[model samples]
Target chain A: MEAYEIVKLARDKKRPTAKAYTKELLTNIVELHGDRAFGDDKAVVGGIGELNGMPVTFIAVEKGGDLKERVYRSFGSPKPEGYRKALRLMKQAEKFKRPILCIVDTAGAYCGEDAEERGQGQAIAQNLYEMMDLKVPSISIIIGEGGSGGALGLSVSSKVYVLENAVYSVISPEACAGILWRDAKKADEAAESLCMTSEYMMKFHVADGVFKEDFSDFKGMCAEIKETLYNDFVQMKKEAPEEIIERRYEKFRNIGVFAEKKASSEKGDID
Target chain B: MLSLTELLKKSKNTIENGGRQFARDEKVKCPACGKEEYRNTIKENNMVCPFCEHHYKISARTRIRQVFDKDSFHELFDNIESADPLEFKGYKRRIEKARISSGEKEGVVCGTASLNKVKCAVFVMEPGFMMGSMGSALGEKVCRLFEYACENHLPVIGFTASGGARMQEGILSLMQMAKVSGAVKKHSNAGGLYICVLTNPTTGGVTASFAMLGDIIIAEPNAVVGFAGRRVIESTMKKSLPDDFQKSEFVLEHGFIDKIVDRRELSMTLGRILNLHREVI
Candidate 1:
């Protein structure tokens, strides 16, 4: 499929939002709220739940299932409070040794004045810094649009997976097109040029795996995701906390692509 | 938000027009106040408008020369250059043009330098280079700097001025946030100090990463520093923003920045800070 096709599919309202995934995948959910420092954000729903009998902390950027709810949730565009709330929940989960499961679906972080006033960049920065060494194993699944640093706030995980139709990019294609071609109408070309589709994401090593969507069998699709998370956690649970953080750090550390001499690699020689 | 093309055009104009306003022989009008001053006079005043105290953007090289001890800076990671990992349209050309215009290999210049006679690792972003966007090379250089600081037991000081992650590199540029943050986390774990001086127009992915991770975060006076751009916020909020919205003073009032220092006093402020954090014998 063309990257733009995948981008459209990723944004399709018919596709399941994080609400459905959380409800279907996890059991006995006790929804958490608030960043402790600020009011809770409706866009980001986080809580403790059971993933197939195993306790887990699940956080999802929910775009809402209806127009009213979407308006309330800012159409899944998280604010600084939203990311802070997610970080607060993740820290709580770490305290309880519960594995983290983040269901990412957002156009991007909200760009409103209030979001900036509350330090959106700082909130996301804290998450990226802390999540790198979070003691417990964590996994992030991009069920829809995994947009920029907002998506990445909860996505500095032990492993990241994206649904087949999900698209992730540094900037949305529309914005990229506007910046690159001086026209938002050129989004299709920008989308193609961005290499944002899940397939390209995997090839770029940004995504570890792709989960083919089975929306017709939503329960079955969730079951597969749950199983994958459970199995991965069970294996990850065996590793030491230090090892978990080291692996997480290394996963992101090796993400960039650059040209350098073999001997130059050891320039730091920290060890 | 200004488009990349506009930024590129502005950069080209700056280069063709003899680079920085202070680099020219003609008088330049201060953006904040209409007072005009000769380039040499403004340069002598550390690029701050003598009348309104308006801070003009300084080049990365000039920033280093102004803040660090004379002849103490030794540039590192100059060998690393940006590459088109995703083969995005016009990425290579943009980089090439940025290289020629900015005279820098990447968006940031990293190295070891002495501040107030105290050794520290430093990085200053080149605003002339794609608006100091973070791509793979920039990220790698920052990560390596933090690592070097940790190993050498030196503090790391960074002057941040970026639009955000470079879209040309796609997810690779976005990943730099996590990558650099990881390195910062490691340095923090080792109890190494990190100080960030936020400059004009620091926003987006860079602000969302190591820029805000600094142990002591300072902003230059009147610098436009925020997560989202003014236009983005204005459109999203559907309201006109206050003139001071996202400026350093506003950010300080909002409790994000520790202090706002004038450019003329920045070197002395940094010197005092370094002295305070200097390791005990």
Candidate 2:
């Protein structure tokens, strides 16, 4: 199958959501809620968890598994309150010397009138600014779809990862088709044009590594994420706070770094 | 509440007098009001309608000339031509049209300029260039400009006027949001100052990303700044929206915008900001 055909599978309605992955991967998970300023947004799930005895904070956009839950979660399109809640937790993590592991799975940030009225654009931009200076180290993993600013709100960190079958795009192919071709039905063609699959996303240097999926061995996949989390904790805990912040700065700074391809290859730019 | 027909009747009479289709003539009509003024009169007033004070969309080059110190702007990052990775339909043709009409190579133009010799990087998006979309080439230029500012310790000023990401570039255009935001983060962490001036109709991915990351965010008076366009939000939610839903005044009231400046005072205001920043440093 082509990349987007696989994207369909990765985005399967029955596929386990962020909540499922967190349940399997983290120990002693305790979800914290609310932006404190506004009421809580159900779309994002935020909490504290343990990985191999190491304390960590996990923030994720929840794409509920079933039709009913999907409506409840707004299909993982988080409103401004959700992003503010995540920022609130990220600051807490920094103050308490906890590493952050954010799971990005939203189709995009909420664009409803009330959401914009509450400052959705500013909220995401604030997250981007604050995440870079988060005193402690942080990592982000795209367990499913990393959609535009929705995914980015929680994913600007020291390291970023993605599941093997996950897809990330700036704008969804459906919207891109609708806007570009004036024919939303050409979404399949738009998907092919968008370099959204993990394999294609590799060229952008956005995600550090891909966690290979084993459908028959889902537990194995959980184990791998846990292992990576543990390893990051061990190494990141030693670095000085300033060094951690600086390294995180450099990590994000290095994205979109590209150079012209050699004369022997096709004449183009590659990251 | 008034019935829908009453509302339609009320608007139809007004729209006939001043709507865009009714405004085309040797003398341009102001959308904000029913007044008609000579085209030269509007342009002479820095493209602000004299009667209603509506700010008209200005070109990137014209904006640079209007804002910077006389003869002090040096253009950068204009050499890189946008490559069509997917061989997208009519992408090249769009590029050609933008180039011929606007004399700009891409959607965004980046360079160094002086606000009274207090150096800063300026990025102005040309609305004519496919509504100043963020394709890979534009993204790379913006990222590089941010890095340049960081390396040189110069403050940055950005003028955003875009419809959002370039659909022709697909995901590549979208990824620019993260890339540019990352660049902004680095510049900010390095103690560099950045100001973003939001212009008319700044929407979509552009509004969601670096456009909002400025240390001091300013907007043109009455500009429309939001994540989703008006039509999308209305259709998706299946309801009419507030008149001020995406307008700059609403954003200012809601706390995203620091201030709104009139077109005539923008340059002086920027110079004042740059001077104040220097004193603090």
Candidate 3:
């Protein structure tokens, strides 16, 4: 299928968005959706698939194109169940020793009163904690807007990549500008300053690389992603499982280090 | 072009002649010395008396700098700006005016710094800016800073002083409490350290989340720290307040804060603590 055709199809709510994308990108894709404690969340879409003949786990935020479908998918924002479902899938991937690839595109985690009552915060926190210990190679790609904890719930990885035009940030640029300056008009400035764009993230080491400049060619994009996945998986397989886990753990352990002047009185003494 | 003695005489004459009678009538007596001279100067010096060692109110910035290394401060998420999600009436305009007036991007500055070469991430809330309210941008920046610290295996230091969550953003502002706390937990589970320094006037949602989750919590002497204001609690409960309610010393006595240190000694104490933690790591 052509890229434009896929884009049009993605905008159509008649069929499953994840199923169509998976069929186009990988072979033998399976759908896995639901947290055992509660009902299934349609916002988060996850499953297993074979990419370039290598087994991999895929997770992405699902959005419905139409109003009815959008409401069904919680407007692409996951509730507590959605986060738990992603966590469950991530753990499954770790257990099977399969490489994990996450595609992030959501406004944020669901912020309804119901979501909060069920420990939305706890679920997201658990995902962050569990992802650090996952003993498998992982990569996260921002295909669209990566918003707040909802996007981050499935975004912890050894390498994080973003589409050229993708925006990834802790909060929406509009939300930041509105809250800080009290003017939604300052959103452009907020976006530039927040380093939400892929180019800026790559410069800051937040993102490893940018994918196809224009996601217009689905076949070509899939091929490129396949090659990248294959290379990353091979490199990850070279390191021992324990070493991989340690490296992944350390990757999250060292983010900001500021210089401090050593105390002169304590400088010379071993004490 | 008046001499110091002439200015003093003029000021004295004005006071004696009742030129500033209204100002003289509103004078606050010093509790420790009973002297009406130079009250603000004492508070500016973290409540330490120049003549005697009487501790007062400590600013959030002073507390953070004291605890970190002399030159090891590197602010993280310094460029992340905030927005008004709710677009509440007059909220945007008021924030713009405040931003220009305060000369700060936001109420809090978060970054990576060191205490005695023990690297840690620190956030200092400036009450001068919008009462150091926690909005979406402040929350995101703080959470991201924690993420950075967790990734780097460093400890975190947060100096909190806020009028509570930003009301201008409505529910979005309140959501930051959970967001920041989640980040703090992730950092802690990664074996990172978190030290919360509560300064004057830390209340509301700020206290409910990361501020209360510090592995080692510290506060300046006499700082006001609580979930709600004294008056509100008193009025709601229909009771008179204690002599030292919500004060740092009182909280310390109640075991909420780990210790109450003078502003001048805060840095040295934090340095020692960081050094000890570094040795353990």
Q: Give the interface RMSD of each candidate.
A: 1.1, 3.2, 10.7
Q: How high a TM-score does candidate 3 get? A: 0.55
lDDT (10s digit) by residue, model 1, range A1-271: 8789889999999999999999988899999899898898999999999988999999999999889999999999998989889999999999999999999999999888888889999999999999999999999999999999989998999999999999998999998998888999999999999889998788878888999899999988888988888899999989999999999998888887876645636332111
Q: Write the per-residue lDDT of candidate 2 for residues A1-271, one digit (tens) a residue.
A: 6866866876888777888888877889999999999989999999999878788999988989778999999999999999999999999999899999898888889869899999888888788778877889899998888888788888888888988888888778788788878888887888888778887667766677899987688888899888987898789889998898778766555444222334453223452
lDDT of each: 0.89, 0.82, 0.67
Displacement of residue A66 (Cα, Å) in model 3 is: 2.9
Query: What TM-score did chain B of candidate 2 earn?
Result: 0.88
Classify candidate 2 by CAPRI docking class.
acceptable
Task: Check candidate 2 and list the clashing pairs.
Answer: none
TM-score of chain A as modeled in candidate 3: 0.86
Every candidate's fraction of true contacts kept comes to 0.89, 0.42, 0.00
- Ten contiguous residues with the weakest lDDT in model 3 chain B: B16-25
List model 3 lDDT by residue over A81-181, tens digit each: 88889888888998898888887777677755345445454466557656756788888877766665666667767777777666666555566677677
Off by over 4 Å in 2: A240-243, A257-268, B1-26, B31-34
* Residue pairs that clash (backbone atoms under 3 angstroms), model 1: none
- In angstroms, how far off is A119's CA in candidate 2? 0.9
